[model samples]
Target: MKDVEDNGLKNDAFLAAAASELEQMVEQICERIGTPLHETTELQRQVLAAFGFGAVYSITHRDRLTEPQAHALSIRMLIKPFNYSEQQAVDFVDDLIRVASNEEVHPLMNTIIHRGINGHVQFAQEDYEAMGRNIQEILAAVQQ
Candidate 1:
């Protein structure tokens, strides 16, 4: 894995302060991603209900991994015995961190991050996004 220059993005204080908000985000994200695949057998969801809960754990460890590594791990850990292309796995991770990672990439995605940025702030959404970035880069960002 490539080593990103440590910029000081390790402080998860924002997450600690925004537990409820994160939880709510997890619930909605997990529900959307964990739905049963109609094309699959068992007439049941693929037991991915744990993704919402499990993803945060994986995401928090982003500092220890490269973006590519994180994406690969996301694929391996996210889907179980079920088969999905590497793209799907990669996209899945991208979708999660993307919102918080880059606000300018898409304006709509920034809605949550922009919520009262200067007043009555609920959370440090940028830090949440930084959590998904390269460890070294994150270090520098956090240091700022």
Candidate 2:
């Protein structure tokens, strides 16, 4: 019983330290990405709440994505100027809802949004549309 109690305490301390380190790292990453730190933290909380830690960690660390990978992530946002059918748009949203729930990829997907969207104020309708498109594209690619 004593050993178990000690182990539990050690685990708690380790988790606290890890959380602090991750918070700092996230802050730096947000700065480097030109995103607001508060927004990044909020997004992280949302992602964790929605998908749990296991999924988010998996996707972010899975590939060590190259520049091409990063660029691809933003392709949908970039293509927003083009016309899309209503069905296509709805399908895209459905796709995001599906993928964002995946335990393995949700974290990475959330990070992609946190970093890519620049964490500005509530996005306008056009911006939201672009983000939705981006989310759909990202989920499709991740699923593949």
True-structure RMSD, every candidate: 14.2, 15.6
lDDT of 2 by residue, 12-90 (tens): 5644443443343334333443445344444333332222222223322443434333232222222221123455534
State the lDDT of candidate 1 residue by residue for 13-110, as single tens digits: 33333334434443333343343343433312222312332343334353344455444444554343334456765565566466546667654333
lDDT score at residue 12, model 2, on the 0-100 scale: 51
Q: lDDT of each prediction vs. the true structure? A: 0.37, 0.38
Question: Runs in model 1 with CA error above 4 Å?
Answer: 1-63, 102-144
lDDT of 2 at 75: 29
Indicate the worst ten consecutive residues by lDDT in candidate 2.
Answer: 74-83
lDDT against true structure, model 1: 0.37
Runs off by more than 4 Å, candidate 2? 39-144
- Candidate number with greatest TM-score: 2
